[model samples]
Target chain A: MSTKRDKVIVCRCEDVTLHQVDEAIARGHRDLESLKRYTGFGTGFCQGKQCVALCARLLVERGGDPPTKPITPRPPIRPIALADLARLVDDGDGP
Target chain B: MTEELTQPFDAIPDACDVLVVGAGIMGLATAYNLARMGAGRIVIVDRSYLCSGASGRNGGGVRAQFSSETNIELMKRSLELCDDFATEMGINVWLRRDGYLFLARNAKRRAELEASVALQRSHGLPTRMIGPSEILSIVPEIDVSGIEAGSYNPDDAVVFPWPFVWGYARACQRLGVTVHPFVDAELEATGGAMSGALLRSQRVESLGQEKHIRAPLVILATGAWSPEVAAPLGLELPNHPHRHEICSTEPLKPFLGPLVADLESGLYFSQSMRGEIVGGVSNARVPPGVDQRSSLRFLGLYAKALTRTMPILGSVRVLRQWAGCYDLTPDGSPIIGRVDSLEGLILLCGFMGHGFMIAPIIGLLTARYLLKNEERELFHRWSLGRFERGELLPESMILG
Candidate 1:
């Protein structure tokens, strides 16, 4: 089932391919939201950081009903590791 | 790698009145409220620093004017909270009530704006439809070449995101709440109910050693990190973190006052107090997934869209360009309140991109829900379980 054409980039950060997302979609998951849960599209090092909009477009093209409304934007644009983040405050970064 | 939940430590004390996971604004805000209500021994553990999530990196637009009555009420109440936030929280939050101007360039969009304005006015929001001639008169800097009509809400405004987080964090600290940065919480569930959480932090300085925290009541305000945190517990939160690229141009003369959102190109911009035009454009390539790398294409798109909206901005040199991920939910509205299956896990996430503006109200609402079962229908409708019930929140006022 993991063929060349099926190898879509599910997550750009981790580079998990399309077969992952397609397999997830084929497994009773008819929506991009569910496909993301099964295929790990949004769960990545970047934390779905750059993949959501692309996934929306892909879902729309793949006949999966796109969200009637536009996707919402959450916080923490950059995913800084716990250690680096803690140090910022110690180094006077509370602003 | 973190180990899966296999055994609960018998020796370590594993209970807290309230355990706040993810030290973002919502978590901190809720924790502060819990602390105020005498929820003693409150501990807030974050896998990262405060505002290291979307709270710090957002457009920071606060307005009472919304297309829907529910959102308008929520924002109106939220605006009141934000107005006195500095004195209430004893932190100087640089909130400027510069007003928000949503400009429509076509007849259809103009009609939509008129309807939204009527809705806003019906709900006591100071908004009205203005002709292109009036639009030009209000903000003369904005070129009205292709603009047909626009919706102007003078009550919408912007603020610095950093201070707001600081306000909540300081308030929480003053209320005797313990905040541990860089501590990751490993959530465990039994029979579909969250039993407890195991928090591990190796950078503790108190004893110059590692530290661990255990709590029963945990709130997940991790924003984009919610999915990863939920994975260990076999729970799924359908929130996607999409990287949104934005930029700032060199400090120009003070020309624009209100936040300008072009409904056509998904471009939103406002001149910061420093005179730099700070805003972003919704790129066409951004799909529903995760990637936070910066791109030159975003800068180009912003320049083109800005020039199209206002011709005078065409010659302004860009100062810098950056990108951040927006933790988006399936529906546009935020997933606030408790996760039903989890005994103590409350979700204050999926604000999409509007968390900063609504943080004050969300903080109060999430806190009240935790303290008492009493809550508005808005919270009930926006629960994380709403998706499982096939109920989706439909919000139309989406900006870049």
Candidate 2:
């Protein structure tokens, strides 16, 4: 009984489905922050770059919360290796 | 216009028994326990959404490895509560009490840990001081070159900060306690006593959005912003805010068994249940004030510290970085309970960096003290009058 919406993966990083996001919306956990926490859509490796807009659209169109401010974007928009960041400076060579 | 808002304040009359300010864990947890004791008409108001304060922005480290007896005792009870948090709060906080390894860099630090472990053991904590080999056995990937020694306890824990806040907010709601976020409250005092607060919506201010409420008792649970909230009401608090930054890496197979901290550098990191390495470093270079902005210097400093501690993590990918203020006191100890200068108000702040960990026991004890009309000497010991009496409790093991 899997439909197209269920099959359509909204968040590639967390593997959140479009239907899953809609269900979280209907359960009163709307808004981008709560929706992100409830559905696990924005906390993955991609950090919501690909899925936040689609989830926001679903929230507003599906009788959830109105469109307010966008979710807060965290730093390191793209993943940075710890080794690369360590060499960010030669602060020292010891612990 | 404020009535259009979805807050359930209309169900609450203008007058109530207790009003808790700041919907963070301290306030939410205290209000939850009070409501469970059948204290009627409890309402909690927050200037922003839940988890927007220090409660939402902490490393979630819970440990009983303090140099002092009282702190160690309080945290021991909190760890017990954390063990039952998932079942009791109906929210999974992912608490793992695997252990906490405090690595000492120099002999002085080693001596400090040695003394702290001795005190912790005397007080029923199974903490022990270990050499470099045992340290290596614990974290196998750690670079123990500069490490002299360590003190470890198997019962220390870390948790996800968000669910701890959410769990208490949910528990309060199930007890008929209303929590309204995004509501800014301006506290009013009459004749040198806390009268109540004037509430307004932060999202939709102006346009006749003000509402006046009355309460006999109020709990000032605002952490870093306590000074700002208390200033207009004519109370000068000694606590100030120090911004701290923390970051997490992408998920991987969980290898680290416990949280590891370098005592000299103030660097602490623990692997989450989702496998991301969450950690932060104490940098004195961060300019003072209520700044939550992250900096490149912090990233560089933290990376250097992490790579120096564990060279193998150099290849790990960092996912995100965020910051929150630490509510600090002059003597490095938390000030709890009632203040002498402020009538009809109880103090629940100045927890410094470790408030998030010890809130469960404090909340329970606060309700027990208020509900049963009993007096705890611990509250009197931590009163604000001690600062004037020069009885400063200088705890030495405070870190990020």
| Candidate 2 lDDT | 0.83
Off by over 4 Å in 2: A1-8, A26-28, A63-67, A92-95, B1-12, B204-208
lDDT of 2 by residue, B1-400 (tens): 1111124334435877899999999998899899999888888988876777888779889999998888999999999999999999877898998899999999899999999999999989999999989988899999989889999998899998888887888788778788876677788888878889988765432323678889878888999989898888888999999999999999989899889998677889999998999999887877777888877767777888989999999999899898999999999888888767768888888997999999998899899888886557888778877899898887778776
lDDT of 1 at B9: 21
For model 1, residues B48-113, the per-residue Cα lDDT tens digits are 445556776677788876666778888888889888888897766667787888888888888888
- Total clashes, candidate 2? 1
Instruction: Give Cα-based local distance difference scores for all models.
Output: 0.69, 0.83
Error of 2 at B337 (Å): 1.5
**Candidate 2 lDDT, tens digit per residue, A1-95?**
45988988989998999888877665445456767766778878888888889888988787655546777888888999888887776755332
Query: Which candidate's TM-score is highest?
Result: 2
